[model samples]
Target: MSNTRPSLTLTLLQAREAAMAFFRPLLNQHGLTEQQWRIVRILRQQGELESHQLARQACILKPSMTGVLGRLERDGLVRRWKSPQDQRRVYVNLTEKGQQCFVSMSDGMESNYQKIQAQFGEEKLQQLLGLLNELKQVKP
Candidate 1:
């Protein structure tokens, strides 16, 4: 039998879990799921985005983004409107409340990041991020 190699997929997931452990509690305190936080962060960073674009950037499926966006809208954290140029396309943006939420959560998030940075040395963390970005450029 051919020797089996360590699973890169599993290793990536484990690393994700380890990284998320740092932010999960803060997200819980803010009553946000990881997906919800991802959407808001993407919208905040990119300004307005089409629904599909938001889903892509947030790494959420298009179908699931609809539901998550619904909750965010209901909670007054996001606002959605039909695109001016395309009636069928929808755009989403953060509301003032969402901006405030991000601001409130920023310090705690930064603290957690700092703790992680301390644990994995700043240089190593930067190197990992750089490598990950490079990996993302690889074509299937």
Candidate 2:
């Protein structure tokens, strides 16, 4: 057998595509785009955060997050208020509705994760996670 080479990014893209196929549908059912869900989950976990912090944590662009946060606030999923110490700074927090949505999404996510775990099995999943972490740790 001959040794073959594959582009690392191509393999990474393939992995991301396959992963998204499984995760995206679950996200859609909860009335969120993946970016929106990312924001919701982050806010749910972190209590409250400024928009800049949310953008950084979500790995989403500031422009998109501005729109997302606006919609979330308009829909009552989030509330934003000027910080007491700095009126120019705004903080965001999950509303009761947002918390409810996060909880509901969590239940669905648990089942989805279980299904993926059963499909991939533990060993392969661990290996995949390790590989991904290794990639993350590489310096830019």
Candidate 3:
């Protein structure tokens, strides 16, 4: 007989996947892909970042960012220009249109966040968030 331990970690992963599946489709309705929405959310928080930095924060590869940036640039949601000091490096910032989108997305995200809080009480959510953050800590 195989010894099987019940795992909260596995359950959490499944719940996260299900939640993302539901939330992501709502953003898609606004003509934004999951990756694009992530970029918008990150920019809303960080103000501005180098294109490479945005890619890192989004947990996407640099190559994938090239296309995402290209699409966002074409949509006029993001503006990218070479850094004044180093022309080789490009910086990305949200345009007014991008900010509007960010605001809407943030509202939706916050609503979903509240639902999560309601599903699991504040204290449990806080504990889960702390545990998740601890799991996400950078390793040297």
Best candidate (score: TM-score): 1
| TM-score head-to-head 1 vs 3, winner | 1
Q: In candidate 3, how many Å is residue 125 off?
A: 1.5
What does the lDDT read for residue 10 in candidate 3? 93
Tens-place lDDT per residue, model 1, 56-120, is 98999988999999999999999999978889999999999999999899999999999999999
Candidate 1 stretches greater than 4 Å from native:
none
Q: Candidate 2 — which residues are off by over 4 angstroms?
A: 1-5
Q: Residue by residue across 1-140, what tens digits does model 3's lDDT show? A: 99898796898789788778657867877899889998988998898899888999998899999999899999999999997899989999999999998877777778887887788799998998898789789585
Query: On residues 1-140, what C-alpha lDDT tens digit does candidate 2 reach at each position?
Result: 98889789998889878777777887887778888888899998898999889899998898888899998888889998998899988889999999999998787788777788899998999998998889888998
- Which 10 consecutive residues of model 2 have the lowest summed lDDT? 105-114
Model 3 score (lDDT): 0.87
TM-score of 1: 0.97
TM-score of 2: 0.85
